[model samples]
Target: MTRFQSPFVRVCWYLSLAILAVPFVFPFLWMLSGAVKSQTEIFAPTLTLLPETWHWENYAEVFSYQPFARQYFNSLYIACVVTAGTLFISSLAGYALARIRFAGSGLLLLLLISALMMPEEVTIIPNFFLMKWLGLMNTHMPLILLPMFGSQGVMATFLMRQYFTALPPELEEAARMDGLSRFGIFWKVALPLSRPALAAVGIITFLFSWNLFLEPLVFLSDIELFTLPLALSNFTDAYGLPLWHLQMAATSLAVVPILVVYIAAQRQIVESFALSGVKG
Candidate 1:
């Protein structure tokens, strides 16, 4: 009789897989559990995989607790705008850097690299003063403008440049032969083939905007103008203590849809990032 793989090896492999998955999977599981669980149940030592007493009211309460719907829309539209702007700005800059032969191209790349390596906190103070001087203080303008021109945009631009640099010159030459301008070839042919890079930029930018805390915290005070992350943190009592139930529910609201999309397109989504040079 032909030998078959042992149950022992299969069990060991499955166990190993489960162990590896815990770090990624556990936080989500906790969020979901915390969303539905009561204040008391959330802190239980054993941990509740399922809600012991499901408090479905938390979902409604999440909205009732603040201007959550408005905040949700704030984060949503900001993310969309930021993502689109980054993709447009990054891709164009990237193509130019990759294809054009201008003086100081290397120096420009160096400056961009420097900006990318520098942490946002290091610049936030000066940026705050700058925003104040420009009359952009306590507005969405800082959130939008800072990121659009900041290291994030630079990173996206570099990613696109790298991707563009890898494309064949023959295509551009063929486009020229076919009476297409450089802009036309770059816009039509190159961009059409660069959908993966675009998707990567869009997704990363969206997540960045969605999860942004420090900028919103420092710049915003109006309840009506708060983004989701800032709004979620605002669910505290008069003593500056947290209201965990509402916070978790709000967090679940903000994060779950993103998680859903990520799971649904895990392969294509992941490949896009990996292709764009952000391996994780």
Candidate 2:
């Protein structure tokens, strides 16, 4: 008779959740199954979930077809660097915007918000020109600098600012009384307590940079400079037909690490959003 033991309610809830999860979960399942399947089996009429023969060599072919291992390294390192840089810069900017009352602070924050409304596509050409002018064309510097200073980073800054603004003023006031300078307080007190916001920002920024395709496509021409997304696309035949087997294998490799990391830190990621919501 208890609500927890209501069979009708439980069934409906479980069924609804299962239905909702299908779209999100099915694509990954398909991707995984496709990764190990032969090209023929992949496009076959039967639409099987498991491969008839698991092409384990598809993985090896992923490496041999191009500088895929190198490409993997490129994506991983770029994502890591972008994540770290975004965290530092956003946290600093966020803390200042949340606490400081200097003239033009409002205008600066407004400008940053306006920057968010501008799509990346609109500015890609200008960005390309800027990068070319700065001698950063065909380099990882554009990848690192663009995302670290673009809408994503600005969004991270706003998230941190909201979290910091919600924090108790007494905490920083006490630190100030103890002769803690602004930088010292930010480094020692504010940053330590802003873990949830930082975690959320880092996770999102890393994933964004990892899956970025267009920026890399435009900025990099060297095969060795290609990231995972670009490298995955390089698996094609002489006639420009996609080599699905190898492409799927490389795609799976590119996605698996990020999937593992997200699953591992899923709890923290959820908590980060909850914390941000409370602050907002």
Candidate 3:
């Protein structure tokens, strides 16, 4: 048997993986432990993985500290909208770019690709002015709209285009023979088959929107409209020092959805990346 197939080798390999994972995993373990620790304990010179005193009330204080629950909901709903919007818009655009022949299509694709290189920091000022002109300030509108058209959206389009470019043309041709219009073929045939790409885009867009900070900071001034990232910062003293216990607790809670999403869709994420990379 190959060395990799041997039980001893397998055990050693797994152990090596565990050892390698500690640096990445320990912060999360520390975060969980620190969530239940007091400020004094958290900043204590001695490194302790477990809390000397379990301050479970810090979790409750997370809600009482600000409009945290509303902020959480804001992040959640915005992420869902951005995810859905990116999927719908990106898929259609990707399909057209990948399969439909038209003048200037190549130029359009090139332009979109160029957009991927332009960081949001460069455009944030222009977008901020535009949103101000439209009277969208102190609202979630910018948060929802900007990302759907920005780098994340373009990346989704590129990924979808790549995936669609790699699909079997025979299936679409067969659908056309059945009296299916282009939209019908796309809606009925191509999209369903592109679930991996869609999932990848959806998950990515959702995460981006959920963790968004800059747009929300610029566009929103209302505490009630704050997303989790901003709200997390509010767990601070008037002197600007973080309430370590409460902040840790809030951060722990804020991270739960992300953890759940990554855990559930990790396999699909890896698969989607692999398939999307095949054509590009």
By TM-score, the best candidate is 3
Question: In model 2, which regions exceed 4 Å deviation?
Answer: 2-5, 271-280
Better of 1 and 2 by TM-score: 2
lDDT tens digits by residue: candidate 2, 1-280: 6876799888999999999999999988898898899988999999789888999999998888888889999999999999999999999999999998899998998999899999999989999999999999989999999999999898888889888999899999999999999999999999999987898888988989999998999999999999998888899999999999888888888888788879988876776666546543
Best by lDDT: 3
Tens digits of lDDT, candidate 3, 105-183:
9999999999989988999999999999999999898998899999889989999999999999999999999999999
lDDT on C-alpha atoms for all candidate structures: 0.85, 0.90, 0.91
TM-score of each candidate structure, all chains considered together: 0.91, 0.95, 0.96
Alpha carbon lDDT at 272, candidate 1? 62
- Candidate 3 residues lying further than 4 Å off, grouped into runs, are 1-5
Candidate 1: segments with Cα more than 4 A from true spot: 1-3, 6-11, 44-47, 276-280
RMSD of each: 2.7, 1.7, 1.6
Alpha carbon lDDT at 4, candidate 1 = 59
RMSD of 2: 1.7
Worst 10 residues of 2 by lDDT: 271-280
